[model samples]
Target: MAGSFHGLTVFNNNVHAQNSDSLSQADIAEPLFDIEKETYIGTILQNAANPTFRFDPRKGKSPSAFFAEVDPTPSAPGINEMVKPPTFPNVSPVAPDGLIVSSPGFHFNEQNNAMSAFQNALVPPKPNITISNSETDDGYNVFSKAGCIKCHAGSYFTNHQIIPADKIGTEPSRAKALAKTAKIFAEPLLYSPTENVPIRKNARVLKIPLNNIDEQQLRLGFAHDGKGGYKTPSLIGLYWQAPYLHDGGVAVGYEHNYGLTGTLLKGKPVDPYRSIIALVDRKERQKVIKANASLHSVHITGDGHSFWVDQESGFTKKEQIALAKYLLSLNKGRTEQQ
Candidate 1:
């Protein structure tokens, strides 16, 4: 105490105050990226085999044109549907050895179709990861482990397969969801059973088989047969694709359910942070709550089930954030490292 520090105290205090202000500003301000710096870093980190493809959104050019040019052709009725697969236009057939054609069998009449199919086939198989390491490489591992990949695999982020929970033997889970909705609906004094409830009408049509494990069997009755079930949605670029779920019930990244607005139900918000804007108005809040309740009911009933993180699965908030980050990166065309 008797001996003073070597450095000047006044000078040190002034420097510290300046540094504190700098730190405070940094904390409050949004981070900005240097495009040139990012590009340089990206170039260095780019994978030779799976190079990240960047396209200018403002230019409004066709994304497909970047890869190759192909004229649209009518489909053969018996062979395939005219609707393009999610994999179309993104995946190409160029062989690793630089060979254009990978297949030997090509018909003169079906040359275009064959080449298209071959290109699709040539697209590299999706990379697989186990749970422990799945979250390692930019957290895409969590997506694969969570069974999200089962439905959302490929360039377009979908397998284009309509998977039914009943077929997957999750009818009991669906029943639980429906029961929850019914209970919520019963509690709302404003929600009259007689009040032209479109959702109630929609829910009545769901016919889950007592014993069905095969999706094909389930799909015969449940796949949009007026029961309102469809293929699992691709989560590709899901960041830009907001208002999550098939019915667009909940806005992406927010807890507020789109259908739950204006319904009397008491529960924690689905996405409280993102839903603040809607919740500002009492009427709007009611509408969002009602919409969410409807969606929550559907989710529980297994009509349109998306995975969630819970203690049983060891998917914590941290993991969910990591998974969300990985998904957002895909939307931006950024690789796992980014």
Candidate 2:
């Protein structure tokens, strides 16, 4: 309903929202998905903390009133290394923690509350991440020049808006997963920050002010007749968290810098610069995509988001390196306020 993130984590929010949307469960459609009471498993949340990596510690975004999310066993997280693609559902999702999870007063424990605070306080490692070369600095310009900055804009590197399949142009399979959750996804209802976990019958509810959210942009966030939305993720930590794309399939090894089947699965690290090259360089990406296919990896197409930075797009190798280095350095020397 608004621009700011209240609880931020989408799938996790579904677990809590099931409480608020308790009534929706009564009429939930078949296939019995996550967020629907039937699909819920009580703990060990599948959510990752990628969204929290560079999040503003000062503000709380979530399912209550501001956060954005969905069901995608089917998908991923920067919050948890995510990308809103419709990975075919491979496993069941565990529910969010909270005694009164069925209500706004969810994740009731004091430690649970503290954990959230700590998560936002944590920052991605940025030590020596940026290259010392002059080209590294120019890379950011190249990124913006190549239109990478359009969605990957702002302090955390994400505008936090969902881009539909057509414009994004990646393989559309993963979106099939996101579209499913969009059906019953609703704005979150949160208990007042001061409310207790067990939740009183009469408790104060936090008003997640969103009168400032861009209504048009919000509409653009959704897909399939406004049911699903694919959030553009924050590009905070690209150095270590490689094997790019939503499926962790767009991988390349240190030797050849190829695909998931050729790299990470075999315990090799993904060459950041080379892998990034493949991401924006279609010729290179075709090789990587083919490599990912060797294993028939689940949802690992590593295709789409047709933004390129290679010579084919009229850029030089020098500029491509600069862009990759800048992306890797996104973690340091800046606060979320930037």
137-164 in candidate 1: lDDT tens per residue? 6467667777767777766677655455
- lDDT scores for all predictions? 0.34, 0.54
* Candidate 2, lDDT over the whole model: 0.54
Residue-wise C-alpha lDDT for candidate 2, range 61-159, written one tens digit per residue: 432212223332111221122111111221112112111222224433233345446667777776345476565558777987888878877777787
Q: Each model's RMSD to truth, in Å? A: 27.9, 12.5
- The backbone clash count of each candidate, in order, is 25, 34
Off by over 4 Å in 1: 1-136, 165-228, 252-291, 294-303, 332-338
Candidate 2 wrong stretches, greater than 4 Å: 1-5, 9-113, 127-130, 171-187, 204-210, 215-227, 294-297, 333-338
TM-scores vs. true structure, each candidate: 0.33, 0.65
Best by lDDT: 2
Candidate 2: worst-modelled 10 consecutive residues by lDDT? 90-99
